[model samples]
Target: MSQAADRLALGRIGESVRREDATPKVTGEFAYGSDLSAPGMLWGRTLRSPHAHARIVAVDVAAAVALPGVHAVLLHGDVPGAKAYGLEFPDQPVLAGDRVRYYGEPVAIVAADGPERARRAVAAIRVEYELLEPVVDPARATEQPPLHPDRPTMRHGYREDPRPNVIRHLVIRHGDPDVVGDVSVTGVYELAGQDQAFLGPESGLAVPDGEGGVDVYVATQWLHVDRAQVAPCLGLEPEQVRIHLAGVGGAFGGREDLSMQIHAAMLALYTGRPVRMVYDREESFVGHVHRHPARLEYEHRATREGKLVCVRARIVLDGGAYASSSTAVIANSTAFAVGPYRVDNALLDGTVVYTNNPPSGAMRGFGAPQVCFAAEAQMDRLAAALGIDPVELRLLNALAPGDRLPTGQLLTGSLPTAEVIRRAAALPVPAPEPLPRDPLRLPGGAGNTTHGDGIRRGVGFAVGFKNICFSEGFDDSCAARVVLRADGRAEIHCAAADVGQGSASVILQVARTELGTDDVVLAPATTASVGSAGSTSASRMTWMAAGAVRDACREALAERERTGGADVDVEHVFRHPQTLPLDPETGQVTGARAHVALAVAAMRVVVEVDVDLGLARVVWVGVAQDVGKAINPRSVEGQIEGGIAQGLGHALMEELVVRDGRILNASFTDYLIPTALDMPPVTIDLVEEPEPDAPYGVKGVGEPPTVVSTAAVTSALRDATGLLLARVPVRPEDVALGSR
Candidate 1:
């Protein structure tokens, strides 16, 4: 054994190997959570309140119990140990108790022979409600009573507050805010609520043992957390309740928290039969959390020469009814408010309010996407005021390899803002042409409402970054157990959920690369073997799970190199370096707490807008991104393309329509997403500058495209209309109003 073979190890680190799971996924043989079935499993359904906010006066489950197929009906009183649970705070009720916060909030569950019977039985169950005032606006949360008490109305933990709807507050004060600049631009931006829109709805199966314990087969991001929450709710020990990872369609941070696991387990334990729960499209929208809707008031000051001077921002986030990661989300939104730029003076205040909107938690971009739209927009506005190129303005403030973030954490990794932007801007813009008279590709879209009208085109530039893995001092680690069999094969065991990010395949690739063996299998992720892989979020699993796999494989290889002489297999965990907590006053970190994936993106959008009908159609889009190290350059480009499509949807078409605290348009039919025909011809420019800190210097590649593309598309629209469309999902009326 010599250094030559060791160089082979380094060779495998950066090459793009074929994804192990690709064939089955493309062939449609891939099984998702909805595809799971078991013998003698009863279908579970939950009854929800029709009212947005109401008091639970009384409940009558006798009718549902009398139904022939109905085996069990469980109420709030049936919860075993904990009545409320949340990812960040214990504010959300597992079952509706004295009050219901939002419409569609689960109140009771029914287990029956089939899904239809369960639905019927759920309909038969009657619950009397005393309708209450619903606090629909976040601006009013401070003046309104919270659905979940601000303090000890339920469980008290590390921190408690005697307050109203405010769940958490994060204020970052950096350089003196009193510093004045030669020129400044002030504006406010609004971001609407965005849904995860994962292709698969929520589905799971829970089998209760006759001995008062249960086992759950569910679609989730973290199996351990699901086990923890369900064990307490079902009145069982953690050891008694085992969780197996079911097939996932896509998570994108939506499935990070508990969904139907508690309800299914509770029903199964009470009914003594395996219960299966599958949410319909509307129910899925109601069952899971959405991204936070925000109102950001931002002011940016810069020298006339384009050097960033100071930044002041006030970000108010609507947490909806319960505190679900709202505290951490506010910290994320406010702390990164200045974006991947260097600002000397900064003063920021972020407050999350508990209103009767649908509770918002983790989405793909987390909190950073919201502020990026504001911060990047400010940069564009400032560039216009100073007559500097938008790209040049950003490059002037672009953080370098050793710059300090507004949070005061040193930017240790690649901060290629200028690099990414310059290359992205150099991308070839699409050729423009006059609007066609053809009826099909008209401005009103498939509806064929407008054939020809006033049309304009515009281009925009944007830069954004999201933390790659978990931060804020959380013990974010992954466990990979690589078992070497006598037959010269390997098996990788870990609970890293594959929610369409290709983490499963990536994990296998990492193992293959490290072990230098092609014969390897990634055992299905289950709580039975591996520890928590955190959530398939923050675009972390690719690096986190891959890191774990490589570590375990490397250990096995090391052991073989020492004793087995080249055929040894072992298992181990790969934990990232620990992060330090952020300082309260200056928002500076006393230690290493910041981790990010930054991508500077630019898009040239051509559109045909009917000023009369206020309908616009995007003609084409061009993009460029820095992926650090494209482990799979092809796959990375695909992800960037798909992310841009979703971002375009957010800019021009996608929004969750909530009224009176109820999600109105919950289905794809009503809530429009982009289709293939809706997607314009996309051209992508890829850059490779490996992140030194990342595994193999591979930067996280999932969320950065999503973070920047939305603002770029919206910026183009603003350029065309000459009117600032401050809000997203720009409506048709907005264009018509601008035409006036």
Candidate 2:
């Protein structure tokens, strides 16, 4: 091919093209939301409740208002319009007025000339509270008095339980509820709350437009959703609130909810000056929702021949305080209760209840990670009881096309469960390194704690799947506008937040491929520029953005052809196949499907444990993921690697210690995450099975790795320890002591 032709194909589909922001990010030239500022900007700070649950007797902001640099001291009553806001349910208070439901709930806001002054003003505000007993346990949340009694009872068109503090209770009775297997294995598992821990804290700059409107430059997942939720609270029309996506350092699902967006906008509008709000490290921990800590009791049954029979599970998720996306989280937990397997019968009860714990909502895998850990552990137990290999057992019952989920949603998309399992299993395992070689490579790296004493190596495998797009009748769609310049370059406009998952690169690649040009530019993501590209979550950005960009490019090309090679601009909205809501009573799909697509992943984790010290180190991870298609092979690999790192944290050391609804370890010094030294070498096999219904046969790839990697790591830990470790963030003491 000529050099010209090669240049045109530089970033087409299937190529490992460089990320658009890679250079800027690596060179330290990238500006995140925290870097946002404007002329005459005042720093905004929030005053949070110290108690978990408390009735506000009175809020005195006189001292705060009299503070030297304080410009505004506002309470809930000062809210221009709505007093409450949330992602799915408007139950969380914009500012706690009558009461505070959870610890760190915002009760008042302060704006000052500087960040220090704002902090001082916040400290000066006095709040008199009447302490109340917090509903700290999800299992007994319903028995407690109502936390949100006046909130609506309906969610996603399903009536919630009338019981107090019950967010959503989903029951799935598939096949025979009374079916019995020749052999059964039961176990109880617990998952601790995990934080998104994105590098950039929640921050935003709200500049009031002179015309009774505001422009919010913030780090958020969805610009349109932010506008939708912020406008009502500001007593402004939707058009009056414009949201622009600032550079996001990372948002595994943390930016999906309101943090400082509304508060900053309110301060900006009230003061008529740019208001900048940024959560410090400590405040960031309390400002956002975490992964729902769960308790799962699972029983897996199988025949003596190693074929699966039935699965029975009771899953309870602690959706702390308010309903952010707890209803949908519970739905996912129930739908995927039985991993990526075909079971003849299943009886699953999944409930997410209100608690005084930190609010739990979208985190990487949503609710699938918690359930996958439990289900995979039960699968291992069943395998042990049936005297079968874990990989063989998984392969025997791996979900295939045409198989129906527990929710009765047929697998019409690409779900290469068995293939991924086989591929992951076939990957060559790393040979054990010679002992007394490098202390840095051991379980307690560089600690010089041991000289390879009591070291044991173990290997384990896990396979899991997750739904691709938003499910349960959400109008999942993306819009893109393509303008073909007379110079033959193309500009693609879509409001899809990148969130550090390389969606911008994917969009650029798709536009270049469709328009047959390498010179393509991406417009800044903003609500004012284009229609909603939905949220940069649920692993849906690539699929949705690609479809929208592809359609828009094609339309623009056709217009150009019609105009005899003149410049053309076209806009198009691409909608996924419609999904139906699940039946509230039976937990069955109301129509052909309840999810847009499904992706599967299989992982084999190898670990070395110091049995005496209770320390563990992951040596290797082999993953086979059902990507449907790889838009950028390198970017896909990065996603897989990043997900494995997060999963490793969950399996080994990422524990958000919450004691009675208070986060004990909110800082990085106490809450550990996987660093470069802790990460293992990852081997990946991308399974490209085309989903017939998807554009370019692509499925979302961000979530499946996280869904299964935690399970795989824990399986390895159990293999080495010979212990029934039922909980995650496996403490060193549990391994060192249990072994004795």
Model 2 Cα lDDT, one tens digit per residue, 591-666:
9999999999999999999999999999999999999989888999999999999999999999999888899999
Pull out the clashing pairs in model 1.
none
lDDT by residue for model 1 over 1-740, one digit each (tens)?
00010001112445654554566778988677777777788998999889889999999998899999889888888887799887866778898899899888989988999988888999998889999999998887788775665452223211233458777766778878879999999999998899989888999888877898888888898888888777877777888988888878788778978989999888888778888888999998988888899999999998989999999999999988887777778778987899878988899988888888788998877888899889888988999999999888888888877777777787777667777778777778766655565665666667878656566667777888777777777788888887886578788887887776766667766777777777776677777776777777777777778777877887877776677565554656677777766665456776765554444455555666677677877777777676777776666777887788778888888899999999989899988888887787888877777776667767677777788778888787777778788888888898897779
TM-score of each: 0.94, 0.98
Clashing pairs in 2: none
Model 1 TM-score, 2 decimals: 0.94
Best model number under lDDT: 2
Q: List candidate 1 segments past 4 Å from native.
A: 1-28, 150-163, 434-442, 561-569, 596-604
Q: What is the lDDT of residue 708 in candidate 2?
A: 94
User: Best-fitting candidate, measured by TM-score?
Assistant: 2
Q: For model 1, where is the 10-residue window of minimal lDDT? A: 1-10
- Give the lDDT of residue 595 in candidate 2: 92
